[model samples]
Target: MTHAFYVYASYGFAALVTIVVTVWTWADGRARRRELAALEAAGIRRRSARPKDSLGDGE
Candidate 1:
């Protein structure tokens, strides 16, 4: 009822998954920041466009 191979396999799989996730997260964060900076430099704010008030009563 021993499980030496199972323990080793589980550890190896965990390590592989951790490495992949870390690399993917780092790349995505860097790319996102770079894109935001470029947009700001071009005077383009994506979230600044909001709708105006709709109570048409002649202000």
Candidate 2:
């Protein structure tokens, strides 16, 4: 009901949101890494491993 209460509540909500987002991002990254490792174990190669064009063109 008071101004201080509202301010503290807003800060608490923001902190909670930040923590949730950080944890989600970290977990997603770990999952992706595991998937990539599994693919590599199956002999899948990345696109960057391909040979580049002799010319300076983007194609």
Best by TM-score: 2
Question: What tens-digit string does per-residue lDDT give for candidate 2 at 1-59?
Answer: 89999999999999999999999999999999999999889999677766676335665
Per-model TM values vs. the true structure = 0.67, 0.81
The CA lDDT of each predicted structure is 0.85, 0.90
Tell me the tens digit of each residue's lDDT in model 1 across 1-59: 45988999999999999999999999999999999999889988764453466335464
Off by over 4 Å in 1: 46-59
Clashing pairs in 1: none
User: In model 2, where is the ten-residue run with the lowest total lDDT?
Assistant: 50-59
